[model samples]
Target: MTVHPSVTDLMRRAEDAELARRAHHDALTGLPTRLLLTQTLERVLARRVTHAPIALLLIDLDNFKQVNEFLGHDTGDAVLLQAAQRLVAATRAQDTVARLGGDEFLVLCENTNAAGAGMVAERILHALQHPADGHGAEARVTGSIGIATAAQHHGPTDLLREASAAMRLSKSRGGNQTTLFDLRLGGEAGRLLDIETALREGLERDELVLHYQPIHTLADGSLKGVEALVRWNRPEHGLVPPDDFIPIAEDTGLIVPLGEWVLNEALRQLSTWKRAGVVPANFTISVNLSPVQLLQAGLVDLIDGTIAEHGLTHEDLVLEMTETALILDRSTMMDTVSALAETGASLAIDDFGTGYSSLSYLRYLPAKQLKVDRSFVAGLTTDPRDAALVAAVVRLAHEFGMTCVAEGVETPEQLEHLRLLGCDLAQGYFLGRPATAEVLTRSWAPAGVN
Candidate 1:
């Protein structure tokens, strides 16, 4: 008995419909996939009126990669499944919850404005705070959400991109929060992207240059050391300040490579100067250390290799770090400091008295010097409290058998006051502005000691 032609056609149609359904839904979490999310967004936007609004949210799980790294992928899958359920529970029936791939979920809320979207985001955040079962173990995760509303003629792709940008901004601001997409933020996000690209190119093209600022002895006015400051001489931008690019590099993890370049270049310059007899045998070079660089694996090895390559002793290099770096990750920071100390490199706390007021770190940190922040030094001649603080810091540094340096002494009175306070070294415009290696060598090391 042969089947009818119409029956055969009907079976084929049914099979096609089932496959389409499966393709639109995620297999792991059973939620709509990115394809369905786009379709739903278009449908909702078409039906939305002037008064009615639709909101699209991009939810990124913070530190989710850590979960996959620490636990197995199977456990990560279980957590995602649990997270999908919680998101579904937090939304209204009309809302579409979607799995937009690893650690990212999307929510489409129809007939909702910013306020309604915010309420949903808050609920989802609260729900996610509870521990989820990841292969019989508990796993906790926080989310950063970026919200975009259907306003100003935004298409589905635009909404998604803007929401993702806002989510990144939230993550940059320490994550586990909600952010709404604004036109200004969109521009800022684009600028940051451009900066990251330019910075990478800058490294490849050798656009980065180091300027040396002379640190002077407070008593004899003799040269103490030079701090290497990285500057970007961009073809388009023309000398971008470290203040502008350094933060972006740190945020994008470009600091790891950028810092390595700075270290190599600084040490190379020092070696050249030493060989040319442009600096005294005891002359030192200071390079600022980004917090990210300190946490890098084999940082100690990298430092040692760079010093050895330049034929410079570790004692001739000073690694200056801000106090904030110390508080970022105490254990890792302590280990890094200890390792550097073992290598015989001098460690100096930069911008002291401005961050992490705990003095306990002073007792344990292997730091050999403290750089008093300019804020205190700027007011030393006028503000009694500032003068007292500077004195106290100097006293503390002395008690710990460490040297104290004052930053930004711009006036004669300020310099006089710092000397009276027993400050060992001072660096500022009043002393000597940051200049090229050639200029510094001509001015400070005119006699080029052999």
Candidate 2:
């Protein structure tokens, strides 16, 4: 059993070769995997001369998951194999096609410029669009392609990243398309990444602050409540507006924690105001809830616990949700909202007339207030249609035994019009701009306030 060194070396080398082959190739499609693709790309890049460009195309199959779910995994595998075969047929013999797994493929185009790369992408998309015969039938699939050329001195990782970013842009533009990576696209992607990172850090480091916008009664101009708007006091970029970061938060699921922070912070401020006797015992604070927050489990418990901790009653808090929130998972959303309403907290449909302008939710859901969208209110004084719409909304809210608030009432004429229409509340720059707690307390607090 004590073999010579040469014999042992030969056996070890054979085993190593087998392992390398397995690692570099996909089992199902028998195409090169990401490892081999990278290696081959590196080789081509190292030998590349000026004006002799190489392009990388990243292909993502659109709605491939639906096919897998409807057909089966076996059928999905067959489709993938057929896709790989078609990709090979579409490219030159010298070009490389690799399977990146899970409905993604990578193609390396040798001596190809942007025009040639685009042609290749088009061919690939056409090939994938046709039905792939499997299980005695054909399955339809589409490809979204991203193309990046080695016109710039980019490494393997950067090239792949650029191509991937282009692919995402293609998918965003409704898929089944090709996008070429440019500086603008890269800049936008980089900006989004920076914002995402900064937002996560901002949450952890308390860089976000709440600014209160006073909501006053249309009849008396008395401060009935205030809406807590979140602002990011980013150190690098001073005072990033909510519109800039909130959508990113929603997309990244950061909104759940961000929403929780907003609730707790608003309650804490309300508690402070109550303790100082700056606001009445019945003073209400409104906080906007993202659709994602409503779908999150334990939202009720979090809200209940926070209110209880602040020694505030449910009536002292208003939860404002957009109309779009209602249409996402109606049954579960209704149940959750019902539980919230049972807690005695008022539920409001914010931007009410803008989305899903159906009267059914007002009749069915536990909504207590309807805030007419600013778009309809913005033209109330000039546009007869806008005025009629606002009046109709106010009337509808009252018919359902709910309060109606008119948003963006910027002018005296608009205020008078809303008052005539029986709007219960109004919020706009003319009433009060969003301000810090100190500024709002100084202005709106009782005359003897600190």
Candidate 3:
């Protein structure tokens, strides 16, 4: 049968309409695309005549990349689709759910204020807790939701930017949480950006310096090792605490280069100390490793080469990391720790008792030492429970053929307690604070001389 020209034109127009609809929606989730979402938001903001309350919720899937990297992109796509469905179910029919692309979804809620947005956000967060692909247990995917009310911003750009900032704050605090955009987050975000920019410049300008804190044998007071801590010596800021900038570096992927600098500089310092005969022959330098460094493909080679470059052996270095870092990525933790251990560099669980599931994770790691966190050590002399806990950890370390280290040994009494508990090493201000090589050589050497 021959089709009429009018019928052909109508069919062509219908196909064009379908194409436009598809372009404005996501293929997998069938939710509105960012283009449509933005258009809708613009319209809502532009219509000042009908003052309607509006809010935006931005959802970021935590560790979603891991799903794609480990389980395959197909599994990742399934998780994304599931998350989109949960976002829809958690909101009102008047709300619009849009895919902001790649594990990020946006919800535009009409007639919702901050408090109302909060309830919706909590619902969406809870809904996103399930495994994305039916095998949720293996993936452990969850969403971080950030809510921003239209009352907070005058335009779509500001609303989305604030929502994104809040989402990042939630993610930075550890995901599976909800955040509402606030002025505090705005200032904090700006401050972090400033710090990040300064830190990058500081690193390049050789303003990054290492200060070594001596860890001494509790019994003999002989130096056992030193932990290398990085500090940014900005011209105007003096010495910026690692706490202030280290997290920024870790989140911004600057930790990789910062970590490399720590490794090389710490090793170089240790070699110099060894040649000076100040440190014992078995003295090892410890450096903290961020989770990002563990995932680096060249981590093992980097460690080996840095050690050799400083004329040091693998045994002369100690790699310290938090258990939570290892627990979050089990497969990588095993491979990375095993590879580092094989390099003859010892591994230590830093801030040992902070994690709730510490004992459980210890079984899987080949760590040679455990550093009791400052919190526990701070209470060692006063709190009987803290003392008992430290004693148990020390004994456990001995049983496992590992040395137990007590960090933040502030007082002589605390040192005594750690010594009596059979702790192998102690580090604190009472013994020696973190110092430059010049001061450490002058201060620490005199103690060993006598």
Please tell me which predicted candidate would have the highest lDDT against the true structure: 1
How many residue pairs clash in each candidate at the backbone level? 0, 0, 1
Give the lowest summed-lDDT range of ten residues in model 3: 130-139
Better of 2 and 3 by TM-score: 3
Which lDDT tens digits does candidate 1 get at residues 1-450?
996679879999999887677558766778887768888888777777776888999898886656654654556677878889999999999899997655678999988899999999999999888988888877878899989888858778667766776787888888889998776765667776667778888999999999999898988888878999999999878999998888777654578899999999999999999898888889899999987787665789999999999999999999999876765445456778998998889999999987534376687888899999999999898999999999999999999999999999899999998898789999999988999888877765667633
Report the poorest 10 consecutive residues by lDDT, candidate 2.
324-333
Q: lDDT of candidate 2?
A: 0.82
For each candidate, the alpha-carbon lDDT, in order, equals 0.83, 0.82, 0.80
How far off is residue 237 in model 2, in Å?
1.3
Query: How far off is residue 260 in model 1, in Å?
Result: 0.1
- lDDT tens string, model 3, 340-384? 888788999999977666776666678999989999999987899
**Candidate 2, residue 360: CA error in Å?**
2.3
Better of 2 and 3 by lDDT: 2
Runs off by more than 4 Å, candidate 1: 1-124, 127-168, 171-176, 179-185
**TM-score per candidate, chains pooled:** 0.66, 0.64, 0.67
